[model samples]
Target: MENLNRSMKLSLEFGLSGAVLLPVIYEVYANISTSIGLFLVAAFACFAGVKFSALKFREAFVGITCTIAYSGILGWVCYLFIHPRVVDMLLKRSVYFSLDIRQQLYFLLYCFIILACIYLIWLVRFGLHKAMEKFKSNSEKTGSYIENAFDDGKDDENL
Candidate 1:
């Protein structure tokens, strides 16, 4: 049972890591200029992740640093694939008061990425809270069952 719970938690973390990368991937596909913004956001994510992971600063700092490095590598790969098209588009077009197709696409992508990240963070927190409550209840029930079983065994022995 404990192993099952551990595996579930590991799966949840894997899902979250994939979810977090979706925005970064989408932004790369839609617009390369936004890659810089994505990297900065990712850095912030690392810091936020550490803060929210509920670990001591000393332990979390390393995790946050590692997260930043991982994000940077992902950002680099994304840039490699998407930068040329974005650069070409920018070169061919001039700035205007109205948003162009590329600009609009970038805007929409940015919004979606932000929303997805926020939602994932919220979901993770909610899941953790519920898991803690369930663990507490299960622990109490187990403790009571053990106590009752021991008492019953002692009564039988006396009789």
Candidate 2:
């Protein structure tokens, strides 16, 4: 169906975006400390959420979630395979840090927090949009009432 095709297209786009962006992001963060890099990535996730807001709510939610999953997978691949190979070739040494259990737990906690923040932003945007629509409708009704009142006064003057 058309909707299925559209959803697949969106998913592919998001996946490709993640595949391309995550490595570049890793390169950018390579020189930075890990904590700072994590924060920067979280900020990037928030920006992704904002960008995804352009789509219908359900579509945006699905797309963004897919994007995040793709990014995580790509990031893991880079960390485990590509990065080690590159570092070993260039530096003639292994440059990698295997996170302890606690570190991993912390990382997961941070990821969850980032995801929650992104959804919160989406919810706020949706709420604001609905509120604005309601406000516009109310204003139009008020305008109509004022116009009717003025027309009634005009009829009285004619009499």
Candidate 3:
């Protein structure tokens, strides 16, 4: 139960972050190139969530996946429901885009790409984590040959 709560919190944090950014970026550009901005937000949120969180391997990935999907949904909701004009305009846009099979396929391709990116993020984060642990272990085994001035008056046994 604790793990689930933590996982949900993590998901909400990153999901909201990306969700908040997506529409603003889309609103600002309102063009196809805005896709790049959305992708950047997704990558940033994923990478940050993966690298910074202390959750285990499976949990981290689960949270990140949830975050991605949740954010996409929330961003759409925000973009559409924010204003009546936007709701109508975006509905029209969606209808126009939905008629194209190619665009639908492209959407699937983008989903696959997002998953691939999350996997890669996990790989890099896991590698760095292992490397840091190894470095700390090795460092602990090796110490300075000379004592510092702070230990000058300390002795192992005097009585």
Query: What residue runs in model 1 are displaced by over 4 Å at the alpha carbon?
Result: 1-33, 42-101, 152-158
Provide backbone clash counts, one per model. Answer: 0, 0, 0
In order, candidate lDDTs are 0.51, 0.64, 0.62
How should the candidates be ordered by TM-score, best one leading? Answer: 2, 3, 1
**Per-residue lDDT of 41-126 in model 3, one digit per residue for the tens?**
55665675565356677777777778778778886787565434544677787631222566544544554466447657776778
Residue 67 local lDDT, model 1? 42
* Candidate 3 weakest ten by summed lDDT: 95-104
lDDT of 3 at 148: 49
Say which prediction, candidate 1 or candidate 3, comes out ahead on TM-score. Answer: 3
Better of 2 and 3 by TM-score: 2
As for lDDT, the candidate ahead, 2 or 3, is 2
Q: How much does each candidate deviate from the true structure in C-alpha RMSD?
A: 10.1, 3.8, 6.3
Tens-digit lDDT track of model 2 for 39-118:
76677667766666656777767766776676667666655655555555646654544456786666656655775566
Task: State the local distance difference test value for candidate 3.
Answer: 0.62
Total clashes in model 3, counting residue pairs 3 or more apart in sequence or in different chains: 0
TM-score each candidate: 0.38, 0.69, 0.56
Q: List the residue pairs that clash in candidate 3.
A: none
After best superposition, candidate 1 residue 45: deviation in angstroms? 7.0
